[model samples]
Target: MSTVHKAATVSTGEDRKPDVILDYNKTKGGVDCLDQMVAAYTCKRKSNRWPMVVFSNMLDVSALNAFVLWSGINPAWNAGKTFRRRIFLEELGKALVSPLIQRRKSVPRGAASLRMLNQIRGQPSSESIPSTSTATPPTKRKRCHVCTSNRKKTSTVCPKCREYICKEHSVTITTCHKCM
Candidate 1:
């Protein structure tokens, strides 16, 4: 029982609403707007842990709120764009993870990962990613100097060996601070 209501009141008429409900309904507009944004796009993941769930929810709401504040301040920014929130969220996610991606020293194996890395960096998928940031990576794939098998093609050079090496022959090593 609510302190304000004192006791549950039986509705004599179908049109009657409780005083508590009326007070709650006053903020329904903002709640509905936030709900719509949350439903449309969210960072939520499937999990039973309450802390992760709460953090994900907070992230979703914060992103939407940030979008609102940004748009309100920059009147001309992304003008007349119908799906501006989606675009904003996408860019924000990329910007957040970009530094980490750039700092990664390991060259992940597999074509899919390479393609994803290239796409994230706004480069063509066919191009090679920097392995250790020693020298300017060659535009063309060179024959692996260390490859014993039928000469494997590679663009990455080994930082440890100081020689042209394919994914098969190279070990992941961290680069210097200046290189990073």
Candidate 2:
């Protein structure tokens, strides 16, 4: 991408080329032209001692570009009462705005494709999912021999102690948390 600004100097009767020319190599999926334009504006403003910042936020760059281009094609589009002269633009203006609007509206769909690819890997069957909703209540168990004083219900079977304990006391018999 390249930009050339030519000014006809009335004082010298000569055509003056731009003091700054920006040239960028074409890249795949890189920042768009509007971002570049914003950068250019920022760079130009920075050198002029313009105390105020030119552009700071990641604005709707494409909209700004379209607006600027529209204003260029017809000064009446400028921000002010002058715009009242014409509410809209001619065919030439539409031609210029269409591409910009399309570019702004366009979004990369490759991410969706990537997601689709990931989903294609595999999906588990319904049978793999245990049906806790209709699952039968767990059967009650006996108390742990180590803590014979407590008679509590649990899930684990402790062959070493030959006793069962509720989930809380199951640990005394060296049983699992599910047993306690």
Candidate 3:
């Protein structure tokens, strides 16, 4: 059996409209080209809360706009799209939490400091550090080796040099001191 296909008619005259009318009107008040760009690259996941979805979408749009602006300002900064987006989001996240992390790191007077102090003492193993699960939390702040600031307690000890440091002095997310 053979199948037949109908050819589209070509309109040519003052009354004729382009076969594809490129409906910009429908898109005018809705999601624009930029929105499509952001949606294409956005990361999304299922969530129980509607607010979470809205927040995630907003974040994606912001990131997309940031990328576009940055690219416009710095032509030489071009990198692979996926890599650039990942890096941008990661850095943004770090920047947003840095202040809070610094605050928390400054007030470390609990099991965290104890762990650091134990590591600094050159103990061969965790067995050497006295485990005080039931002990009361320390009330005083410990000094940071990097800044030597007694204003804040030490958050973690540098694994490399075994020096106590506040969260601000920590190099990365792992909370290792800059000396490492």
TM-score winner among the candidates? 1
List runs of model 1 lying over 4 Å from the truth: 1-19, 105-180
122 Cα displacement, candidate 3 (Å): 4.9
Error of 1 at 57 (Å): 0.4
- Residue lDDT tens for model 2, 1-180: 233535522333255333332122224325665566455433233445344343433333544555567668877543576443133333445776899989965654332243444457564333233344654443666554345565555655543222344555545555544323
Q: What is each predicted model's overall lDDT from 0 to 1?
A: 0.71, 0.45, 0.62
- Provide the lowest-lDDT 10-residue window in model 2: 20-29
Residue 161 of model 3, lDDT score: 40
- Model 2 ranges off by over 4 Å: 1-59, 78-180
Candidate 3 lDDT, 118-169, residue by residue in tens:
6788765455334445434444556776574354666465544444567776
For model 3, state the Cα shift of residue 46 in Å: 0.6
Please say which candidate is ahead in TM-score: 1 or 3.
Answer: 1
TM-scores, in order shown?
0.49, 0.16, 0.42
Weakest lDDT window of 10 consecutive positions for candidate 3: 1-10
